[model samples]
Target: MILDTMKRRRSVRRYTGEAIPGDVTEEILKAGLLAPSSRNLKPCYFYVVNDRQLLAQLAAAKKAGGAFLKDASMAIVVCADETKADTWTEDCSIALTYMDLAAAERGIGSCWVQIHLRKDADGNDAEANVRRILHLGDTMRIAGILSLGMTDAYPAPHEESETDRIIRL
Candidate 1:
């Protein structure tokens, strides 16, 4: 059943405007915090954004594109303090995956968005924008963002087979 739940999980882009319940959101965050980290170093911090105005500002500043933040009911900003661990990125990623499965179990849809540390060739600095908006310290880094809401469209099933990607040496 756990595998089935994971199988059902997908990157949902379209969402109903209704907000996710506070308790459910809390549960999802708890699940994320419970995820295992390298050498038990938990460097992740979560910023749960439910305010529409703030969300709009974040969407614009972060350049999420395609009205994702505008339509999603809530966003979870996952950040890491680099001083806390060398593997903060990998740790945060695992936590995000846990949150995704937990949300799926509760019928809430979610999508993960990666944040970059430096501006791209066109001069886009999504991480800097996020840090400025969230008032993060210099030591903190934006790891990723999770958009959550009730889905208006069901995601298609995953097509790739993992059998060929794994090897037991």
Candidate 2:
């Protein structure tokens, strides 16, 4: 079930350095593309990066918390065209979430690294740095990056917990 998959989903940083088969990668990308968008204006874009050099560059896209991407087998840079949708952030986020869950279901580990509104180590805009590395257009606003691969560690599923946040009126 989807909920079971969600429970099993965890942010895995360390990868096994094993290459994910092309079919599995394609399936994960398809899940992102299948994500629903506001008003059906699919503005999100997914950039798959498998090159070791580019992954290392992307790992340094932000100031911290992204170095693990360098060891990932592949990464999907999620972006959206702000000119096409005002809800670009939300749209891209859903796409990333879908992809993450899909990866987990297929036994692939993944981590979401936020990029929008983030700063690089040198204080330059993280999004700009990513754009330079990926050659994306100005209109393409990055939401985040998803580092995917096989992992030696898979944490246990999350336990159920009561929450005060949910209320039915």
Among all candidates shown, the one with the greatest TM-score: 2
lDDT by residue for model 2 (7-71), tens: 89999998889889899999999999999999999999999999999999999999998999999
TM-score of 1: 0.88
Where model 1 places Cα greater than 4 Å from the true spot, the runs are 63-66, 117-122, 160-162, 167-169
lDDT of 1 by residue, 110-167 (tens): 8887775544335778787778888898888877888899976768779668798888
TM-score of every candidate relative to the true structure: 0.88, 0.96
**Cα RMSD for candidate 2?**
1.0
